[model samples]
Target: MGAAPSAGRRLGWKAGLSAGAALLIVGIAALARHRAGPPARCAPGMVALGPRCCGEGQRLDDAGRCAGAPSRCGAGLSAAPAGCVAPGATVRIAAGTLRLGPSDWEAQGVVEAREVFVPAFSLDAFEVTEQRYAACVAAGACAALPLRGEPGVPVTGVTLEESARYCAFAGGSLPSRNQLAFAAAGPSSRRYPWGDTGAVCRRVAFGLRAGPCGWGATGPELAGSRPDGAAVHADGRVFDLAGNVAEWAAPDRPGDGMSGTHGGSWTDEAASALRTWNRRLVPVSTRSPDLGFRCAYPP
Candidate 1:
């Protein structure tokens, strides 16, 4: 009877050991499966933040906390005083011009331009491209403007009213004629943004190659193409104020049929025609292949 009891006790100990070994094997298999599985994919519109997800275009903002929704820029909010509102905001105009350049053949054709203070604002760095304008048209924010070729080309044939509507949608207003001139004039008065030196047309201006007399043919060039010649503000904003395309400025007052346009077009002379103070005006409804606009915003 004693031997039988001892043998039973030994069998019970073996059973306990086998159960413990099985549990250990199951745990190891689970761990291996977890490590061998594919990594989890990040969701669309969710920026990764270390092993977690965050909002698009948003970072930890130095506090290590996720930024809230309704993105600050989505509902008419600006990130910085002079920063871009959103990735695709339409340009806004902040002020108007008080005077215009002379049209006389002689007299250096100085515009005697006046200054109007523009608060920190935002503008479409690129002229309204065809693709952007098309989206506007589809959204019913603007009328469909004609296009010749690539949808990436700058949108032309848009009237002042149409342009203003686009800007308003993007949280901006049409620049007064004065504000337009101030941007073109830059901080100091010089013949052009790159100064009075007789630089190459491609460098200072955006037109085709000039002949011996320095007159060039007309062609559309990329916006902000003159990277080396761009004017950089203290805030690190680079602008193609003189070369990209001629932009329309807002009209002055009632019965002011003459709307101002700034910047020398791709076909303009590199010297006198591209002066910073140079200003010209045409009818508000006038549209040209080389004419486009950039917008400004309120401070």
Candidate 2:
């Protein structure tokens, strides 16, 4: 071996190595930060976080280079949306007018058809499922599900009051009849969710219809069973709009202790029930196996 170096010499050598390593690290970090700036804005599939753009599976961190592990958007927001993580939970619907009732459809009972303007809001892609509701109950946020349906089935046996509570727990509110209409019919006011006419064949809205379905059927099938079948909105996002279950909504007026349930259910086969203007008034406390609900967020 060569003669041992002096302590001062060894110390100097070690300092030089540390400084070089630190510079390399600094250089790499700088490059990453620089890359996140402009490219983030123009990049496809990238979301803007501050001045930086983030790629899939990466979100903006405090350091601002898009390497942070993302947290789920708590009630009122959606994830990047690989088709809704929970119950019909993806897609953002912009603010627009909800055509309350189409001119051609005949009004039934207390339900009326008309046009009403509503603010922007986001809605679930599918109705809330049994398993998600159970989780809410377990977390102390909602009541126990009435009868433990399948995990993928829409939760039923819930009263309007309970549905409202669940919406609150989910960081949203029961959709207004106006909001529901817009989601189903879109801005242009298509008659059926599948579009202007029944030319397109779609699976059961996937449940049962008990009356002379102006289609002839009603019953609980499964939520999300018909994946590509959710109705399309002109702007963006697909909705399980007129699916089997009727959804709860605050009636035209509130505080009367009366609410409305909209949409066709497994028991409904009336042509009017599936129409955009179908609105059935019910006591706020009423619960039915064929009625379920979704949450809505303000724009």
Candidate 3:
């Protein structure tokens, strides 16, 4: 009011107000940044996920906290909520030199009968029964077969690929020819699974003078049907190594379109065919009524 403000003075007053408003806005932005703070830091061995950190193989829980994932089992084990566990009973066989086949086999150029060093491994004490294979099929891991035996009887009519699939589902692989020989003969290199003694009806289930197992067995018998047929190993005994059903074994050469069957089936009429060293080769896709298999695992 004292001589009315000059034009320049009014303009200066407006500029001062604008500068003060800009400074206030800058201060508010700074305060917001300070409240928000820097990005979250994760501890070692952990990674930041959103607003939280999770460890390896871990994820966020419903409470927004880090949690562990379900762990997977290794070979020869079954998965559970707690962890992995053995699928079934297994007999541990000590590593030893396998004197494969008989002298006659080598002489006739049937097999080399080489002395191979076999690493220690574990094997199922019994042949895979129909029930077991059926479970695998139900789980969508194995293929179906024309199963004829009872649930306790050894599974048959399974192709090599089907057998392998079942073995994998059981957390194992097929036994090698050398491994089967060692399990039957051991270090002494016995001629038969029990001993050098000949296979009789009382000791094995084979085609007898009358019929298979001295009975009219047209197909496979129950697993462990003959208790005397068991073979002693360093850790325990395995049944049906000489008869009941011929077991699928890994081929002498892998990927050769050929596979091997060890032991002998009830259809065999000759004791020589039941010897531990005796092996029969067939196409990988072959499926026989007397063909079955067992599984082997790491010791």
lDDT of each: 0.53, 0.60, 0.72
- Tell me model 2's lDDT, rounded to 2 decimals: 0.60
lDDT-sorted candidate list, best first: 3, 2, 1
Q: What would the TM-scores of all predictions be?
A: 0.58, 0.63, 0.67
Which lDDT value does model 1 have at 51?
Answer: 24
Give the per-residue lDDT of model 2 (tens digit) for 195-246.
6655211333422333222122223434543333456754455545665588
How many angstroms is residue 195 displaced in model 1 relative to the true structure, after the best TM-score fit?
A: 3.7
By lDDT, who's the top model here? 3
Cα lDDT tens digits for candidate 1, 68-129: 44132212223332211223443333333322344223224344534445554555555665
**Where does candidate 2 have its weakest 10-residue lDDT segment?**
209-218
TM-score order of candidates, best first?
3, 2, 1
All candidates: CA RMSD in angstroms? 19.6, 18.5, 26.2
Question: Which has the better lDDT: candidate 1, or candidate 3?
Answer: 3
Which one wins on TM-score?
3
Question: How well does model 1 score by local distance difference test?
Answer: 0.53
Q: Can you give the lDDT of residue 31 in candidate 3?
A: 96
Please provide, for model 3 over 136-171, each residue's C-alpha lDDT reduced to its tens digit, 9 standing for 90 to 100: 989988888776534555788888888888989998
